[model samples]
Target: MVKYFSNDVDIRTTWDLVVSAFWQRYPNPFSGHVLTEDVVFREVTADQRLLSRRLLTKTNRMPRWAEFLFPANLSRSVYIVEDSIVNLVTKSLTTYTWNLNHTTLMSVKERCVFQESEGRPSLTRLRREAWISSGVYGFSRPIQEFGLARFKSNQVKAMKGLEFALSNLQGLRLTVAERRHGVSPASKTQ
Candidate 1:
């Protein structure tokens, strides 16, 4: 089992190794790269419109072209334009094709433990101090029994790797498929 942690907080533990492996295989796209003015300043509305039309006309098993037509609400025009450039670059540089794997990782959460210590009381204040220490000790036993220590340790490890990847991959971008306006007859309606 692998663990992930961020900012001293545990995120996930089990199956984290799988996630890390996937990340290593498919590194983030936007990593320490800058977009030139030519790339960012170029006109895209016309191209987007053209692409949208092509997307509507091209009907195939994979409806990826439709991404240009009805982009996700969160999609940015700049990223889309950049993606178009990347696509062109890939086509031109046949020897250096881009390999991006768009996959999601699953995470699970479980309860964990925390501990704190209190100072021992003087003999003169034995009654009050005894109850305090006893209560604290009682809670610690349950926390340890729950295997929270193990969970926390794993969580920390997983998150550290995730954060490292995210930070290093400077140009990481996520693309979501857009939905077409018309629904197919076979599709269920809301």
Candidate 2:
């Protein structure tokens, strides 16, 4: 079965600030599960779009009752690959991420779009679309269901993390014309 989730965040900042925060959202208070993130690749297209690829490692606990249902190798850690593109002309950012490991057990795909709100030009909008699925034994159906529930629970925390990161970044930009790529305050080791 395929389970889905959706949410949106509105921040009183330009889309640029929102986009900048996306690159530095990890290491925030609410995302302690994230262990590390590395930029695998980054480049600017001829049309001036920013494209980036990243790898992230995270850890999460399995419900105590379901511990025995998974293999011993099913530790808490999960690795994922993320790809993002920012279009200057459209003033929008699009991201796609999926699990690199644990595909046999399940697959999680997430898509996010950030843009300047049409109604509120001074506000940026973040939209998320994610789904989970598994093909393994009949066990995957239940596993996916459990994951969806956990995802829903964690969704709010994730948005708060983003807001915190964005706030830190927004404070750094003295002006909209000045490009600020400074590292997020929470981007460093806690």
- Which candidate achieves the best lDDT against the true structure? 2
lDDT, candidate 1, 110-166, per-residue tens: 222111112311101100000001122323343232323433443444345445664
Q: Compose the digit string of candidate 2's lDDT tens values, residues 40-152.
A: 99999999999999999988687776777777777678898999999989889999999887777778899989888997778988888889988778688788988788787
How well does candidate 1 score on lDDT at residue 165? 62
Off by over 4 Å in 2: 174-190
User: Residue 75 CA error for candidate 2 (Å)?
Assistant: 3.2
In model 2, how large is the Cα lDDT of residue 156? 79
TM values, all candidates: 0.19, 0.85
> How far does residue 105 in candidate 2 sit from its true spot (Å)?
1.8
By summed lDDT, the worst window of 10 consecutive residues in model 2 runs over: 174-183
Instruction: Point out the worst 10-residue segment of candidate 1 by lDDT.
Output: 123-132
